[model samples]
Target: MTEYSEISARLAALSDDQLTVVLQAATAGRPAFWAVRAALDEMAGVGNVTPGTDVSPATAAPGVHDQVTGGGVSGQVGAASTVPAVPVHPAGIPDAPAPGGYSSGGVPTFESVRDKVEQRFGTAQGMGELDRQTPAGRSADEQWEAREKAARERLDRIRKSMHDNDTP
Candidate 1:
């Protein structure tokens, strides 16, 4: 038997589930999947293709439909009749939810959230709210210098750890 006939026989022998699995495997991560889809889309008259002056419909490969008219090679020898295109909706597919509204429970309004935040921290009255106060003995400059020294020490330890293969 010819390769085409063999393929047709194998396809005909596959069960519905087996055919779906085969189709999924064929399309998964394959570049040809998009090409076939584009060809189908062109055949279904979904996209327009600019006609090149170089190649005409007569020169196109057999079974390839003309992009301009969404028809098979017009009057070309060995061209098959145009097959009726059916819109394919895969089984178990859920209809997409309409836009502009939350699907789940109600969300808090931005105004309400802003009002709560303003009520909590929008005044200078709540300024001294820290758990630990700054050192009373040290001035601001001295405290900043101490922080800088601590940061430098920590950075030096990290640099030493990165450079040294074995720590002393």
Candidate 2:
């Protein structure tokens, strides 16, 4: 196989246990993990408390609930059914949670981090009328910019330290 094809096949063979270790390392303090963690925290705060529902994406065991839910083997011994099962949400749990938690209505669609940052900061231009109206909003924007700059600088320093300590 060519180098790219060999790499692709190797990646395809990675088990879920192996992938979880890679994912945790990659997302340690990043925004994507932060968002997912926030969602999980919201779920916990609401005390969903179902036997299978409390499983975290990181440590969740595959097929543990399958036995109880009748996700058992079909007529063909090893073949999984081609039909996709519809997800059933429990009562009182919101279909889509907003940034912090549950909202009044409407399903929350996934937005790009850039889009969310722009929306939060009013840089998406016409998105936030109220943000453009007030002096306090302008102050908050300035504070956000300053904090973002500091975070970037901190990351730069950490990267530099890693590079400097690398073995030749």
- For each candidate in the order shown, give its overall lDDT on alpha carbons: 0.53, 0.55
lDDT of 1 by residue, 80-117 (tens): 53332223436576433224332223555455667778
- Which digits, one per residue and each the tens of the lDDT, describe model 2 over residues 1-168? 254466556545654333333334344578758766455444333234556555567874647532224242344677664233322345576554456433446544445454677676775565466775789888888899999999999999999999999967
TM-score for each of the candidates:
0.20, 0.25
- How does model 1 fare in lDDT? 0.53
Best by lDDT: 2
Candidate 1: deviation at residue 24, Å? 59
- Global Cα RMSD, each model: 21.6, 25.5
Model 2, runs deviating above 4 Å: 1-127
